[model samples]
Target: MSRDSLSPRSRLVHDALRDAGIPGEIVTLPDAAATAALAAAALGVEVGAIANSLVFWSDGGPLLVMTSGAHRVDTAALAERLGRTSIVRASAEQVREATGQVIGGVAPTGHPAPLPTVVDEALAEFAEIWAAGGTPHTVFPLTFDDLVRLTDGQVAAVD
Candidate 1:
């Protein structure tokens, strides 16, 4: 059972996870889980095991980047690799508009459309990882392969 409350967006994320054939149960945090570090502590996992779903504005509009909590993304380097002019952090409104989820709770899979995604290779080090479930206080555990399959993201060294 989840310790935190479930939101409409979180439910959508749950459904998406199920539909993607990823076996994970929604977990509710007692307090806010707006950061991967906080979620790692709550879930009793290494910081690197948390998959932080971040949104960026690139040449192609909204881009989803699911990164490892232990590393900071080098947006410029990533943009260069993608042949993008730049990669800027998206605003809260832009995040909501693109993902239909708020800033802190955006899931890697439950977006409004199929967002081009970049997955941090660092996350591949962990066999199991946790990510936000479209709500600040909810999360779900999944394997790296499952995450890649669910999001259809490209694995790269974004940091």
Candidate 2:
């Protein structure tokens, strides 16, 4: 889709990518890609190639975990790894306030402020990864290294 056709949130993500010198175009899908499974189906790629942006509440406040679709975040392990007291899932309102986007459409970038991010190392297995474009029907492609660089995310075994 053209830049002009992007939603406000998508526009923010688009701009963020551009400013970061990341290469990708936001692609609007014919159907909603609210879940990694749906996004993978729409893109005809393996589900593991979808980077799921998840927000959580940690001792340091909001934390973003960009995980691979093939696995689930191990909160306990993550807490231990981060040396945090606890890491719990953020409520919808908390997510929106932190990321400026809804749960299903949360992107790795374009947040109101920079959030401490941890990206799943497993995602590096895929050459091209797809992430939400600030909306359920939109997405963008990037390399694993580009994603880590764009978010300044620490590479970890989050799942």
Winning candidate number (lDDT): 2
Give the residue spans of candidate 2 off by over 4 A.
none
Model 2's TM-score against the true structure: 0.98
State each candidate's clash count: 2, 0
Give one digit per residue, the lDDT tens place, for model 2 in 29-140. Answer: 9899999999999999999999999999999599999999998999999999988899999999999999999989999999999999999999999999999999888899
> Where is model 2 poorest over a 10-residue stretch in terms of lDDT?
1-10
Taking every candidate in turn, the Cα RMSD to the unseen true structure, in Å, is 2.0, 0.8
Compared with the true structure, model 1 gives a TM-score of 0.95
Regions more than 4 Å wrong, model 1: 2-5
Q: What is the C-alpha local distance difference test score of each model?
A: 0.88, 0.94
Candidate 1 worst ten-residue window by lDDT: 1-10
lDDT of 1 by residue, 81-147 (tens): 8888999999998999999988888899777788998989899899899999888888899999888
